[model samples]
Target: MKIIAGVIIVISCSAMLKKDDVVRQAFDHAAKQTLVMLKEVAIKLQAAKAESKNPMPVAPRTLKDGDLVVVPSRDWTSGFFSGVLWYLYEYTGKKEWLDEAKKFTAAMEQEKWNGKTHDMGFKMYCSYGNGYRLTKDATYNDVLVQSAKTLSTRFRPITGVLRSWDHSRDKWSYPVIIDNMMNLELLFFATRSTGDSSFYKIAVSHAKTTMKNHYRADNSSYHVIEYDTLTGKVLKKNTHQGYAHESAWSRGQAWGLYGFTMCYRETKDKAFLEQAEKIAKYIFSHPHMPADLIPYWDYDAPGIPNEPRDVSAAAVIASGLYELSLYSPNAKDYRAKANTIVQNLSKNYASPVGGSKGFILLHSTGSKPANSEVDVPLSYADYYFLEALLRKDKLEKTSYKSIQ
Candidate 1:
């Protein structure tokens, strides 16, 4: 009861926000409130780990190998966990948090990632990047190299993009997802870090494939597409995230925004920059976007209570916005919007590190196919929350006020 009261009070602080102001100040205040409850948050992670009798995927989901390692109760935990550690380390220059982050980094190596999953970018690279930056562990470098090798193996020459899904149907390779665009950043990073050009070439080709097919006339993206790998043609563009064939999913749009910005960062391609700006502009100006930083799972989705919001997507975009801000030649407004999302999420949506609750965001959607936790805490939600925090902390430290 007391905890609920505290949460309510903390949430009330969110109301201090106004439209024009960048949200860093409000977010910092909320984070300070969370620090008051940080010990409880750490304890929750331990308790959840110890009291666990039900094995992996918590209780709701079945035992899939991918879900066991490198997952929050939902997918996308690393982006949050590593993001938080990165944020803390950046702020305090502490060694303890850095040490704790090392374990997760090491644990990811055991997972079965041969680049068959779109999430490889979200999982291995995110944690490995943390490991490389934090401890400079030579082992981490080796693990990253292996994961890159595996990820590259998924590159379908016929499709000119990495394949995503391998299940139930003899591992069909035609379907490409919009989320794959975000994953290509790993290739660019791997190439630059390893002085290998193959990685860069693959990343560029993948981006081009997405640009040509996955998007609609309005610059919105489709969640999935069935491609003709042999002929390098798109067979069908379906709506895994949307309501119908052409409806746009807001989170997918956010992925497009963040992903294209990342594409531009790696390739310096003018096309990617323009596409990112288009997506960001649509997302920011759209009437359906909630007053809060979070967005509905689909833009045209009916406002039923069952509809899910993608806080993880928002976090991803915020991090991308920060990068876009840095990379954009004359794009001040995009940076400001990015800064705004970070500030707003930190101020309103993020849950403090209280009572062993590793989740940073309050609302996230996951695996609608399983009728899973609809509007609940998710691993990726937590990941993006942490990522947003890291971006905010870095911006603050650099004295780089967000451009308005």
Candidate 2:
């Protein structure tokens, strides 16, 4: 009897160890592939810089048809590669990654004064913001404050929201997209850096207005909300990238989830926390969410298993849920969901050693409506995936309260 009991105990112990070993292997695979992708991009960036006296500063954007898609520094996604480099440095404590990160970040310095669009946060904060956070560079702080000022120029106090674009006037007057929620972090950071309350006020007002108008009854958000600039009335609710005018885009949902989770972190606002929980419920309860936890481009898109999955959306959701899990009442559930997403992405969506043309996550649909960038690997997807892993690693090494 004693011998039989010992055998059973050993079997159970071995099974647990095997499960832990697989998890560790998945994380190490993700990190090593990311390093390869960064080295591949650095070579291209150096070549692009050598070709012209005043280069546009090309960097990786996505992989389409097994080829790399590089974009100019002014592109909205340009900051993400730099951000990913910084995260790599943070993870490996490697000086080479830090050197490359500074080079990419310096190439994007001109975006601090770019006021033509609402993506300044995506343009500056992700790169310079992370740079500043990690290094405490005074120069990066100056650029971030100026970037916040430029981003503020688009704020329409009458509408209590930041105008997203000036060119889409033919369709709407003053448009505010749900993705703008992600940019508020730049504003909040600026206030803290400069001791200016105006930036904080604008950010809070934008969050409140978005909460009031952007969300539908089901807590899923519309892609775009047009408002009367003069009268502050909602002009229209439309979908620019989703399957239909009323469908919920997968990335849009992830943006809302990440934005409010971040908002609660910055302000300790219970309302924002509750909103994030509701969004999580909507996503988890939706039938369209795949069994593996990756979602299609749009939840309401016609094809079920036939639809292309958006790994970028999954990456963003997992990153946000990791932070959200630290503060929510459903902490364990949120953490488990985030782990499932990370596991699925690492196992299925991740590119093998030399498969992704130096990009990481696969099958990220950019805009199905516009017939653009479908089933590709995006740079931002790689950024958020690394971020989720780093966050999880930090949580494991130290308690959540000791993170800061």
Candidate 3:
């Protein structure tokens, strides 16, 4: 009996080692493929920049009718490509990636003062924020602080939330989309870097206000919530990119999940942590969630199985879950779900190596209702996918408690 027990233990250890190797191989393959694809993207972006009259190309957003759609630094998604480059630099420690990241990140520095839109965080933080985190460049520090100031300008003390859009005034007086939750990270970073409690206060206020108003009874988030700035009351709950006002927009839900998890990390507030867990429960327990964990563009979209899978949403959820697992009591379940998401994204959603015009993953829906960027590879999808992979690798190799 003793001999048999010893053999069982040995076999179990061997299987564990084999599983680790397989996970490592998956990460390695993803890294290699990403490097190859982004090189081609860099070459194409150069040509586009040379030909275009607009600002220099910051990143590739997606394919439009099989053509690469590169956008300028002003675009909200401009920072994601730079973030991806930074992630590659983090993973491989390659000088080439470092140089590329700096170049693209520099393009976004001027946006620190562009207060026309509320995407200052998406534009500056994802670029300069990552750059600063990696290299601690003093120049990036000023850029981030200025960016946070610009973002703060959108915040209304009455509303207790930052305004999301300046356009569509007739439709919404003070629109606060669920996506705005993501920009709070810039505020939190600013406070930490400068010891300015105002930035922290604003972030906390926004998170608290959003937590109070953005979620349904089931914890699913609305895509847009318009506020009466005068009274600080929610005027309407609407949907610009979702299927309906009442439907669960997959990407919106993902943004909330990631945003709250990050808020908890920065604030150590149990409310934010609990909100993150609730959002996670809503996402994973949805009856419509695909078996592989990728979700359709919207949970209540007319078509179910036939709807386009939003790989971007899956990437964001996976990344968020990895972080949430570190703080939640259900750490094991969260980690397992995150692992499954990464595995499925790597195995099923990844673009063919050397294909898809250098984008990493395919079949992302940016805004299906608007007939824009449907069933295509988005830059943000690739960024979050790389982030999730890195988080997984870090968690696996180090003790989670030590990381905290």
Candidate 4:
């Protein structure tokens, strides 16, 4: 199934098929390519994680796997390093990466005081999911459970949005960011883990609020929509992820698609399926979409007219599409779309030049604030890329247990 290595042969054979049939075949081919890339990327990343002596990268400073420290004065995602190893485990089913990811699971507690942002998904799931899947270690489970409990405590009944903190001059507020949707998967998992439905209820309620208030009529999504701290009403829908009001941020859209798909997977809700598909179509049909399926930072974005694309967004959407396909009326179309994205990402962005010994995908974005970390490398990009690969691999009936 190392499909990209023989894509030319596939293209030649594909000419005989009908348009719909061709799309299905193309996606199937791409899914295979993604698998090959995941296997290769994870193998190299595992080596980097092992070679790390202190689990922190040295100054002169470039990012590497298992490195405890990452770019300072940057987004929280950069520092959450071991999560990549966990992705490797999930994608490749390799035990060594899981063992490595476990080492960093406990650090999130100590780092919790690093000041929470709208990225609890990065903080909690990277370790919690890895730990649960790897050792079935209840210590990791306990940490995740406690972290989620801590997170759930922040949910505001008034606003129906979780509070995110970034203290400035002794102030913090219920800054509702779209990325919070990704963290809802934790709530669904917590319900199963603890037999408590309260977490699930809160998550669902928040998602409903977000759906009603945040999305534009055109289906483009806003990044931040501030809730009235005192009144629990929608104060404003702003664009923190994009340039102006009502702008469509690509990653935010990706989050909605991925998040809603996860919700549907857990609850079997048709509404979530519809919402996920709506966002997916917006992303797919956007005029700014490049020949390669990955997107520029935002559809109506400026600055770099051809600004670097985010592989993380593409990977997340592809993963969501795979899930969406499972429940679609035209299952083949959804799956083909998912597969094409996986293939494009695998062949174009994935390092066909062969391992850098560290980086997996070529392009990923971080905070747009202060123009810091624009189109730079990212850990979550690597993590979700692995996830898309694994999700596709699982559907193929391949034995993931071999890596373990």
Q: Considering every candidate listed, which one attains the maximal TM-score? A: 3
lDDT of candidate 4 over 72-189, digit per residue (tens): 2124563245555565555456666566566555545543333355555566676566667766877766766666676787787988877655543132245677888888877777
Q: Quote each prediction's TM-score.
A: 0.79, 0.92, 0.94, 0.77
Off by over 4 Å in 4: 1-75, 78-80, 90-95, 109-118, 167-173, 303-305, 351-357, 398-404
- Per-candidate Cα lDDT values, in order, are 0.64, 0.86, 0.88, 0.65
Q: Is candidate 2 or candidate 4 better by lDDT?
A: 2
Candidates 1 and 4 compared: the better one by TM-score is 1
lDDT of 2: 0.86
lDDT of 1: 0.64
Ranking by lDDT: 3, 2, 4, 1
On the 0 to 100 scale, the lDDT of residue 396 in model 3 is 73
lDDT of 1 by residue, 1-404 (tens): 99999998877665433422343443454345335323433554466678672333211111122122223422534444554555555545667656655644555565425444656677767777666766677877777766676788888788898887675244335677888886786777778778989988988998988988888877888888887867988887886646666777766887888888878877788999999888877777777787765777767777643577877778777777776777666446755666667766767776654421334456666544355555665555555555665565556556555411
The sequence of per-residue lDDT tens digits that candidate 2 reaches over residues 83-162 is 98888778767898799889889988888888988998887888999999999999999999999999999998899999
- Summarize candidate 3's per-residue lDDT along 214-326 as a digit string, tens digits: 99999999988999978999999999999999999999999999999999999999999999999999999999999999999999988898999999999999999989989
Residue pairs in candidate 3 whose N, alpha carbon or C atoms collide under 3 angstroms: none
Query: So what's the TM-score on candidate 1?
Result: 0.79
